[model samples]
Target chain A: MSTIPAELRFAESHEWARQEGDLIVVGISDHAQEALGDVVFVELPEVGKVFAAAGDQAGVVESVKAASDIYSPVAGEVVEVNEALADGPEALNEAPYDSWIFKVKPANAADLGKLLDAAGYKALIGE
Target chain B: MGQRTPLFDLHLALGAKLVDFGGWDMPLHYGSQVEEHHQVRRDCGIFDVSHMHVLDVSGSQAKPWLQHLLANDVGRLQQTGQALYSAMLDTHGGIVDDMIVYQTDEGYRLVVNAATGDKDLAWMNANLAGYDVRIKHRSELAMLAIQGPNARQKIGELVNQERTALIHTLRPFEGQQEGEWFIARTGYTGEDGLEIILPATEACAFFNDMVGAGISPIGLGARDTLRLEAGMNLYGQEIDEQVSPLTSNMAWTVAWMPEDRTFIGRAALEAERVRGITSKLVGLVLEERGVLRAHQVVRIAEVGEGEITSGSFSPTLSKSIALARVPMATADRAEVEIRGKWYPVRVVRPAFVRHGKALI
Candidate 1:
């Protein structure tokens, strides 16, 4: 079973959202990383990009197997992006929960509540 | 659930990630695909390839029948246990399937791809009009490939004295039968290795013994990357019924000499040669960060456009590489469009690595 931290909220597409003050930090969940095998490259969203709604295209995560699109879990504007992933994409596989892909300034903070909590996400993945 | 190999239970015990591949439930990876690829390149690794079909062809007219059936000349096999790689072409010079044929004491043995087995058999049977030949599908057998630099030394320590002697004496591209098992020095991975064909009932025990002796169990995921790095062609990706061998970097496999030998598709191939081949397969190296995938558009400046046949991140080269079909006029530079962005790539020979060494 993949790690599902209780503090994080997740989208059905497998992106995780964690609240930190006014900004929401985002990364792919452990389940997503595990399913993707070895990550070879990551195309992080540019800072200042805007996603008007939840589940919008944020970036791309490519594994050795195939490439997958990363979606934003909540409506947000990208305040900061993970530039380190450009050189060391394997960190996403080694430490997915700690490796945030981007930091988002939510357009609506209440959108986090609409996402699945730890238990709900676990159930959704059939864990 | 798809068809399972004789080593299916053993694969499960090794914590393999199972996936459906050409109607068979094969292991995609034991753990990390990249790690398994590195293992095969650096050390010894084993693979269960029993999903592939093995057929024995024997008859008084076996040699003549095979000469007509394959594009490569079986007459090239000077000695028993010698193997030859050939393409089985259709009437239009298009590839039906690529296979390895070995000269045995009785007659010959062929190993074909799993998904193309039924079609190859049908084609083979239909073409045997006046031949006194018999085709037997040895589905009761299992195949395993032990590959890498240390493969021979590792395998030599496990089997009996007679098998060990045969393993050491077997030349490259040769195979010999030891009782019920047929051991060959040919492998899909470019590494020096052995491909062993044994009875299905004895597969699990040998696989377990190999694992117990510290040989890693590799999966199809690594197998694809290994073969891609070696620049070998994949059947559905590089060559198909619609694609001719002349354009798929497989022109060498087609035997055109002995001009009167008139094999299947010979006339069409000759016509294609006279018409001047337009497109040819070449390799692409992406120095950029992102991976190159199949079906990506390849723009060759003023030459023309083409498509990537097989593309992936090569663990050996530590970069993304691909085999693309481009116009014959294409030079040493091209651009591949990945995710709407055109990334410049260097064009070279199809092979990127061989024997754990980078070629490009």
Candidate 2:
């Protein structure tokens, strides 16, 4: 089982987010990082990018194994991007929830209700 | 539905992330894939290759039958335990599968992929009707690949000294039996190592024993990268039923001797040789700071466009590399388009890293 923090919520696609004031800081889940093996490159969403809720292919993460798409968990506008990932993409693997791919100001803050809490996400993966 | 290997339980115990690969439920990685890849390159690593198919072909007509069935002349295997890598092809010279044929005292043994076993067996059986050879699939056996430069040393430390001596002196592509285990000094990682084949029931125990001996457990993720770095082609990606060995960069595997030798795809391959192949497979190293990926376009000034068959970030080189099928006229250097940006790349022969050292 992944070391998911209780303070964060997870999307079914494996993106993890934590609510902070008006912004929701998002990255991949611990399980997602482990599943991706070693992340070598990350194609993150640029600042000011608009995102739709659920299943929207927001970006891409390429590992030594294969490339996969990162999906959006909720409707939002990108407010901040983690530029550190450009050089140290493996940081996401080392510390997924803390890596923080991008911060988004949720268009509908209530959409967080649809996402899974740490306990619910653990059950979702049958952990 | 998905199938499982004999070591499926062992992989689960090790916390491997399971994935469906060609209908088989296989481990993509045991927690971390990069570490597994590095283990094979630096130290010793073990891979559960039980999902690969092993078949035995015997009888007096074995030599003659295999000679006609395979693209390479199997009769060239004179010494017992000598191995030959060849392509089983259709009449049109399309590769059915690439396999390693080992000459045993009884007859010949072939280790092929599990996914292609049925088709390969049926194809071989159809042609062996006239011959006296009998083909038998060995699903009861499990295979383990232990690779790296320190592999034999570690294996020597684990097994008894008597078996250790035998394994240490074993030539590449040669296998010898010690009790129920068959150890071969052959592997796909382009490193010095041994591939051990034993009874299915004993697979988990053997895997645990080897891991206890400090052999890292690797998965399909590292397996793919290791093979790619070694310039070894994947069956489905590099060569398939629609692609011939000529275009697949496996022409060296084809035997063109004794002009009279009539293998399954002999005529078509001979014609292709005479007519000249239009496309060729080559290795690409990205000169820029972008990852090379499959299906990316290769643009050349004089030569035509080519496509990347397999591409990834090479852990050994710390750069993006790929295997591409390009026009025969393509230059040694070309540009690869990645997300609207063209990056300079150089074409080089593979086996980029061997024996824990970068070759280029």
Candidate 3:
């Protein structure tokens, strides 16, 4: 079973969002990382980029096998992008939950409620 | 449920990630694909290759039959146990499949791709007219490859003294049968190794013994990367039925001498040479952070565009590399379009690494 922290919210596409004050820290779930074995490269969204709605293309995660698109869980503007991932993409596989990909300033913080909660994500992934 | 190899249960017990590969449930990886690739380069690793189709050809006319059936000449195998790589081409000069053919005292043995087994057999049978040849499909056998710089030394320790002496004496591209086992010093990975074809019943026990002796079991994921790094072509990716061996970096495998010996696709290949070859396969190295994938458009400055056939993040090079078919005039530099942006890449000879050393 994958780790689904009760405090975080998840998208059906496997991204997780945690509210840290007005900004939301976003990363992929543990389940997502495991499915994508050994992340070799991560294409993080640029800062100040605007996502008009949830489930928009935020970045890309590439493994040796294939590449997967990462989606934004909520409508937001990119506040800060993870720079460390540019040099050490394996960090996504080693610590998926703790290694946040980007920080987003949500246009509407209420959009987080529309995403799946921890228990809902667990059920969605068939934990 | 797809077709299972003799080592299917053993793979499951080793916690392999199974995937569907040409109607066979094969292990994609045991845990980490990159690790397995490095293991084969730095140390020894074992692979289950029992899914490949093995066939034996024997008869009074077997020599002439193969000389006409394959692009490479069988006459080159001057000594018994010598092996040669050849391309099986269709009438249009397109590659039907590429395989390795070995000569034995009795006759010749061929190992072909599993996915193209039915088609290859049909083609071989269709061209058997007026030839006194008998083809026997050996489905009851299993194949394994143990590869690395230390592969020979480690495998030598496992077998008996006679087989061990054979392992020491077996020259590269040579295979000989010892009792029920046929061991050859040949491998797809660009490393020193042995490819053993043995009875299916003994596969499980032998695999267990190797693993118990501390050889890492590699999966198909690493196999692709290792071959790619070695500049080897995959059947569907680099050379399909629509593509000719001349454009797929396999022109060396085509035997053009002995002009009287006409092979199946010889006429078409000669015509193609006369008409002029347009596109050629080359290697692309992306020094940037993103990965290169198949079907990505490759653009040359003043030349025509081409496409990447096989692309991946090279574990050995620590960079994205690909085998691409580009315009014949493509020079030392090219650009590959990833996502919506164009990234510059360096074009080099198809090979990136060999014998655990970076070639480019």
Q: Candidate 3 residues B1-360, lDDT tens each?
A: 999999999999999999888889999999899999999999999999999999999999999999999999999999789999999998999999999999988899999998999999999999999999999999999999999999989999998888899999999989999889999999989999999999999889988988999999999999999999999999889988898889888899999999999998999999999999988999999988889999999999999899999999999999999999998899899999999899999999999999999999
What TM value does model 3 have? 0.98
Off by over 4 Å in 3: none
* Tens digit per residue, CA lDDT, model 1, B105-158: 989999999999999999999999999999999999999999999999999999
lDDT of 2 by residue, B1-360 (tens): 599998887789998988888889998998778788898999979998888998989998999898999888887888777888999999999999999988888898899986898899888877877799888888999999999989999888877777898897899889877777778899998899998888999888878988998788999889988888888889888889998999988888899897888999999988998999999888999866668988999987788899888999888888888999999887879999987778899998755777777776
Alpha carbon RMSD to native, model 2? 2.4
Top model by TM-score, which number? 1
lDDT of each: 0.94, 0.87, 0.94
Interface-residue RMSD per candidate?
Answer: 0.5, 1.4, 0.6
- Fnat, 2 decimals, each candidate: 0.95, 0.65, 1.00
Candidate 1: TM of chain A? 0.97
- What would the per-residue lDDT of candidate 3 be over residues A1-127, giving only the tens digit for each residue? 6567899999999999999999999999999988898899999999999999898999999999999999999888999999999999999888888899999999998988888999999999999
Q: List the residue pairs that clash in candidate 2.
A: none
Going through the candidates in order, state the TM-score of chain A alone for each one. Answer: 0.97, 0.95, 0.97
Query: What clash pairs does model 3 have?
Result: none
DockQ of each: 0.94, 0.61, 0.93
